[model samples]
Target: MSCMQHLVALLALCLSLAAVAASSNHLPGGVNLNERFFNQVRALIKRRMQEKNCARVHCPLSNVHLQPPLVDDEVALQNQRSYDNVPIPAASVPTPVLVENWPTEQHSFGQVTAVSVDPLGNPVIFHRAERYWDVNTFNESNIYYLIEYGPIKEKTIYLLDSKTGAIKSGWGSNMFYMPHGMTIDIHGNYWITDVAMHQAFKFKPFGSKPLLTIGKRFRPGSSVKHLCKPTSIAVATTGEFFIADGYCNSRILKFNAAGKLLRTIPQPPEFLSLQVPHAITLLEHLDLLCIADRENMRVVCPKAGLKSSHGEGEPAATIQEPDLGRVFGVASYGDIVFAVNGPTSMLPVCGFTIDPRSEAIIGHWGDFKNPHSMAVSVNGSALYVTEIGNNHQTNRVWKYVLA
Candidate 1:
C-alpha cells in the first residue's frame, strides 16, 4: 500500500477543500490531474455518498489519511483495541471445514482473492497463487507478488463440487497474471477479473472460451472504455453489471448485457475522503448497492435504482465497525450481508456481518489470519471464505455452515 502517495493526495484535497471553505461556496474549477488529485476525488465521492443522503446514518466523514485509527495509527499499532473478539451465541456460530488438495505444489491458493457459487451450489474460487494484488501506482516492473509459486502449478481459477469439495474443472492458467474477483451470472456464465491484466472476462457455462470481455486488456485509463485494477464485480439478473474500479479509479462502472458502457455511479465530486471501493454486492430485492470502501474502513449502501437505466443512487445508509479494518470482498443473500478484509486490516477478526434492516454490527469470525474473499449461498445457509496462504499459513478455503 502506497500510504505516502495517497496521503500526499489527501493533502492536496485538504488544501483544495480549505480553499473552497474560504470561498464559502461550491468547489472551484480546474484542478491539476495527478495521483493526489485522483485520491482526493475518490475520497470526496466516498464522503458524500455516506453523509448527504440520509438522516438516520450517523457515520462521520473519516479522512482516510488524517484519521487516528487509519492506515498507520501508532496508537492502534501498539495496543490496538480488540473490539470484535467477543463470542457470539454458540447456535449461530459457524463451524468451518477446510477444502484441501489444491493442484498447486504448495496445495494452497497463495492468496485467495475471490469466491462464489453457481445455481447448482458449485463453488467457484479465484486466487493469486503466484501474484499479489497491486497498489494504485502504475507499475511496469517484473517482480514481487502476494505469493510466489513454484514450477508445479500455474492455474488460479477453479470450479468445485459442494458435496465432496472436489475440483470439477480448472482453466485460465495461461490467462491471468493476478487473479482477483469472480462471480457467476444467473445463466451459469463466469465473470472474472485480473488486475495485472486489466481486463474482465465472461465465460459460457463451464466453458473455457470467453463469451464477452470488458476493458482493454493491459491498458489503464480514466475513460469509460478503460479500467484501473477493478477489485470486484456485481451482476444483476438482467445481465447489467457494475465494477468497483478501486486501485486506480474509485467510481463504479456499470455496463449493459451487451458490454456497452451504460452509466457510471456516484460522480467523483460527491465524495470527501478515501473512496477506494474495493468490493461490491447488489441486494436486488431491496435496491441496495453495497460497496466496500476499503481505505475508508466502512461499507456504503447506496439506494441504487435498479431500473434499466444507470445513474447515481440515494444515500441509504453507511455501516462502520471500529474493528472492521479494511472492508474488501462482500456478498449478499436474503437479509444478510457478509464482508471480508483486505491484506492490511486488523487481523484478529478477518470477517464480519451486517443487518440490513437495522444497520447494526452482528459480530466477526473465521479463525484465520486474513479473510481474502467471501461468498454467500442463495438461501443464506452457507458462507465460503478464503485467506492468504504462504509458507507460514495454511492454504485453504473454509465452508461455514450458517444456521
Candidate 2:
C-alpha cells in the first residue's frame, strides 16, 4: 500500500513485459529477432571502437557472433561448421530425338485403303488407283500398262516384305473396281472388299487368282447376300468376320469363314442422321460391336447377334464433339481403344483411347496432318498411323511411342 512498494511492483511488471517480448522475438518468422540482432551488433561495435578510440570499423560475416559468450556444449556444437550444403540448381530436360523417315515404302497408288501382315509378316497394301506414268506414258511399260485406263485395268494389292522393305509380289486382274479393304486370316488367305465394285473377293495367300466373289455389281441393298462399299472390316478370333456395309448402305454384314452370310447387324434408325459408318471392330470381351459412325461423329456399338435396328440403345458412350471430330478409324488393342480423327487440315492427326472400365477418353496424341488408318503393335507399345494429306502421292506411316 505504500508509494515505494507500488513503484517496486510497477518496475518488476515492466521488466517481465520486456522479457516476454524478447522471448517472442526468438520464434520463427519474427521480424523483431533480425532487427534486435542487427541493432545489438551495431551498438557493440560502436561501443568497443569508441572506448578503444579505434579508427577501424569491425564487421562479422554472421550476426550470431554478437550474442553473449557461452562455453555450453550445445552452443559450441551449433557454432561448429554447418554440415547442411547449399542446393545446386537442377539441369534442364533434354530434347527428344526424332527418328528420320520411317515405314520406308512409298506407293503412288491412290489412298492406301488397307494394310495387313501376312503369315510371313510381310505388309500387304491395297490401293484404288495405279501409279501414274510420265516417261512411260506412251510406251507399253509394266508400270504404264498396269495403271492404264484400258478395259483390262483395275485396282490391285501388293505384298511388301516387312524386313526387306520390298514389294515381293502384286496382283491386279480384271476383277477389282476399287479395293478399299483387305485382311489376311491365320490360314494365310487374303480377303479383299471392293467398294465401287460392290464385291468381296477371297484369294489364296500367294495365289494370284480369286477363289470366291460375293457381289456381281454395284447396287445398294441389291441383296442381303451382297455388300455395298464395305469400308472397314474385322475378323474375330473365332474366324467370324464383320464388315461395315458402309457408304450408301447403313447395314453391317457379318460372314463366316466359308463366305456365308451368317447375319446382318443393321444400324439404329434413331442414328439415321449418321449416314456413313466408316469403320467396324468387334470388342470380343464385351461381345460388343463398335462402328465408327463418321458422319454423325460418334462410335456406336450394336451388340453382336442382333438381326434388326434397336434404335440406338447407347453409344457405349458418346465421344465429345471436336474431340471425336469425325473419327474415321476405330481399333481396340488391350485396354486401349484408338480412334483417329478424319482428315481435317485444321485438326492435327489426333487419336483417342478409352479406358474400358470407365469408357472415358483418357489419353490423346497429336502430330498428324491427315491420319487415315492406324494399327497397334502386337505388344501395344507403338502405334502405326498412315497420313494421307497434301496430295500425298506416297503416304507416310508414323510410329508413335505410347507411354
Candidate 3:
C-alpha cells in the first residue's frame, strides 16, 4: 500500500463521514415521516441555522435583517408561508352546532341543573322546583318562591322528547332542594343528587317519587351510610352505581341497585389530596372512573367500582383535564369523554370533549351562561347541557348534536 493510496482512502472515508453528519443534521432520528412536508422543511432550516452559527446573538425583530445570514432564513420563511396556505380539510374537524334551544310553550325553568338521556332516548333533567341557584348569594337553601305554589305546583324534573324538546312529562316535585346530578341505569332507574339538601335518591325510571334515598334531606354527613353534598352518579349495566360524594366528603361511594352501600374510596394520593372532586363519569368498558378534581383543575381516574379506605390518591395515569376555572360535569359515552366548565365570570361558559386515554381536550364550544352538569346520548352523537342561568334564574337546556 502506497502512501498516496492510503491518503486517498482516508480522504474518501472523511468525506463520507461528513456527508452522514450533514444528512443526520436535517433528519431527526425519531421524526414522523408522514408529517407535513413543510414541517420537515422548517425543522431542517432550524437545524441548519443552529449548526452553522452556535454564536448567534439575539437581536430585536427590527434589526433581524441587519445580521449576516446564519442560515437561509428566506427558505424557512417561504416554507412556512406554503404550509400556512394549506387549508385544513373540513372533514377532519368535528362540526358541533346547537340543534335546539328546548323551547316549549309555558316552559318555565328555575335553574334546571342536571340533564341526562334515558335508555329510551329521552332527556331527563332535575332542577329546583321553586328555587333557582344564585352564585351571587350562594344561599341555595332559600327558595324565594319564584312562582306561587298553587294547586298545581312546580315540577323539578322534566322528561322531554328528543325531537320536539317539548316537555313530555314531569316528576320529582317537592323532592329535591338543590337538584345537582342525575342519571338513568339500563334497568330504567332514575338516580338524582341534591347539593343543598345533601341527599341522593333512587327513583324508578320516570317514577313520580323516589324509591330509596341515600342521604337524609338537609343533612350533610360523610359516612358509609351517609353522603355529603353528593354531586354525581354513574350507573352500570348491571344495576351497580358509583357516586361522587365529593363536594365536601372528598370521596366516592359504590352501591348496589338495591340501595345497599358496598364501599367508599376517599381521595387517592395523586391530587396532592383530592381538592374539590366536582364531577365524575364511569367508563364502564375500561372499568375506570374519570373524576374532575375541579379545585386543582385536572381530571383523574380511580378504580372503577369503589375502595374501602383512602389510600395514596394516585389519579389514573396520563389523564388530565383542560385548564379552566372549574370543571363541573363529565360524561363518557362509549369512547368519547365529555366535560363542561365555567361561570362566565371565572371562565367562559364552555363544553368540550376529552380524549379518554390521553385526557387531552379535542374539541370545544363556549356560549353557555353558567353550565353546571352535562349528559351524552348512548350513541355518543348528542350532548345535553343544563345551565344554572346568568341571573341564577335562567332556566334553559341546550342540546348539541355531534357531527
TM-score of each: 0.68, 0.61, 0.67
Model 3 is weakest, by summed lDDT over 10 consecutive residues, at 58-67
Go through the candidates in order and give the C-alpha RMSD of each one to the true structure. Answer: 13.3, 26.7, 18.5
Candidate 1: segments with Cα more than 4 A from true spot: 1-106, 133-153, 268-274, 308-311, 342-347
Residue 394 alpha-carbon offset, candidate 3, angstroms: 2.7
Residue-level lDDT of model 1, residues 45-76, one tens digit each, is 45433434331453222222223334466764
Model 3: runs farther than 4 Å from truth? Answer: 1-95, 100-106, 133-153, 206-209, 267-272, 305-314, 318-322, 344-346, 390-393
Looking at candidate 1, the ten consecutive residues that score lowest on lDDT are: 59-68
lDDT-best of 1 and 2: 1
Whole-model lDDT per candidate: 0.65, 0.55, 0.63
Q: Tens-digit lDDT track for model 3 on 1-403?
A: 3322332344454345445556454434544343343343344334334423432553222221223434467777664322122322323334456885444444667777788898788888787655655663233442223223331246777888888788889876655556788887776788888776677888886576678888775656766776777888888776778888876777877778787877666533334356667777877655667887677666677656433233322444334422344777887776457777765232345666565543345455646666778888876677788877634346777788778
Model 2, position 337: C-alpha lDDT score: 65
Model 2 misplacement above 4 A? 1-99, 105-107, 131-155, 163-165, 267-274, 305-320, 344-346, 377-382, 389-394, 401-403
- After the best TM-score superposition of candidate 1, give how far the Cα of residue 217 lies from its true spot, in angstroms: 1.7
How many clashes in each candidate?
A: 8, 1, 5
Judge candidate 1 against the unseen true structure and give its global Cα lDDT, from 0 to 1. 0.65
Ranked by TM-score, the better of candidates 1 and 3 is: 1
> Better model by lDDT, 1 or 3?
1
lDDT of 2 by residue, 115-230 (tens): 66665556677765543324543232112222335422543667665544456788765656556667776576777776655667778865666887776555435367766666
The CA lDDT at 6 in model 2 is 33
